[model samples]
Target: MKKLIINADDFGYSAGVNYGIIEAHKEGVLTSTTMMANMPGFEQALNLHEQYPDLGIGIHLALTTGKPVLSNLKTIIDVDGNFRNQAYYKGSFIIDEQEIYDEWKAQIEKILATGIKPTHVDTHHHANLFGDFNAIYLKLADEYHLPVRNNFTNTDSNRRTTDGFIYTMETVIQSSETLEKVFEEYNSVELMCHPAFIDKFLLNHSSYTYPRTEELELLTHPRIKTLFSNHKTIELTTFESI
Candidate 1:
């Protein structure tokens, strides 16, 4: 039988986001989540993790769209103290790899210090794989001996092309043949996804907010479940389970 590991991202983004992740875990097939240490409600997410010890928790490395955990802001921070935004804005900025690595190590240490042995590590906005940043990310994961979400999920292509009204309604579903090929080629894989409902708050506050909501729906879709039945066959193991 194939096993499945459903993950919810952005654990500490907000109260609403936290609530949504918990709900998805309780009612949906959510098996894991990535925590944003710098988010406003990070403490709340950590608290929730304490209550649900079984919930696979990992660090959501945020170098692109939020505040940095380390004080060496020169490496990750812009003119402001906040992390550089990669989700909505685009610009050619130099990444101080050493400072970035130091900050990431500090963040991982902070998460581990919280007493929750992180199952794995992933990044917000997929910044870990962005440009030269991936080297630092891979190095950290290797040092920790933790699995990372390295493979792409079809949900990435399920964005809304028409009017912004419809979400995953335009999901260009991928072929199972292709999905299988990818899994076979990659061996251990981490299909990352952000499955959530895009409410008024999300719409007003988030960037690529619509696509994210669509991503959530696609992840939970019955068709996706059926297609990836027994996701373990594709090496869909949790970050730490590996």
Candidate 2:
């Protein structure tokens, strides 16, 4: 059977983002989301999860955004003490693998401490795929026995992931024809999206803004709901189920 998992990332970024994610899952085809442990809205995301028990949750691990959960990291942090930005990951700056592992472990543990069973693991800005971070990413997944978002570059025979991963937000959100093609092409796929109702925090912090509202509209549309629900071969699935 063809399975599709529509996962909204950055679940704990802000109240606007948290509300938008809940709306998408409740009113649209979204089946899962990943939370950022160190984000401002982390507590709100957990409370929202209590209200929507069936919305599968996962961890969106970070090395690029916000402050690290663990203190005194010599390698990953910038001079100002916040974690390095996305540009740092894209460049050739050296990172300590042990720091990556420890910080991520703390992130996972923080989520687990809240008594929420996370459904999977992924990275913010797909940062875990850079350099030796992929190995640590898979290692944590193995240690915790959680599934992961397939970036198509990192592979582990024992890891649990969908058959394919699809991105390119602008094209998918604007064109239902393109979304339909995605379902037709893969037996199982994870489509990553960031849907939000813009607020001051989101506006001030994130560069990829306005398009989120477009994604929210597309996701919650009745036609999009039918496209996923009534499709003959496509099954809406969650990482926990897969």
Best by TM-score: 2
RMSD list, candidates in order:
7.6, 1.8
lDDT of 2 by residue, 133-232 (tens): 8889888999999999999564456678987898875465345477667766667788899999999999988898999998999889987777666566
List the pairs of residues colliding in candidate 2.
none
Winning model by lDDT: 2
Quote model 2's TM-score.
0.94
Runs off by more than 4 Å, candidate 2: 169-180, 183-185
lDDT of 1 by residue, 136-236 (tens): 87778779877666432223333211111111222322546656554444433344556565556556557756566555566566775566554445433
Which residue pairs in candidate 1 collide?
2-230, 3-232, 195-216
Total backbone clashes of candidate 2, pairs 3 or more residues apart or in separate chains:
0
| Model 1 worst lDDT run, 10 consecutive residues | 159-168
Q: Would you give me the overall lDDT of model 2?
A: 0.87
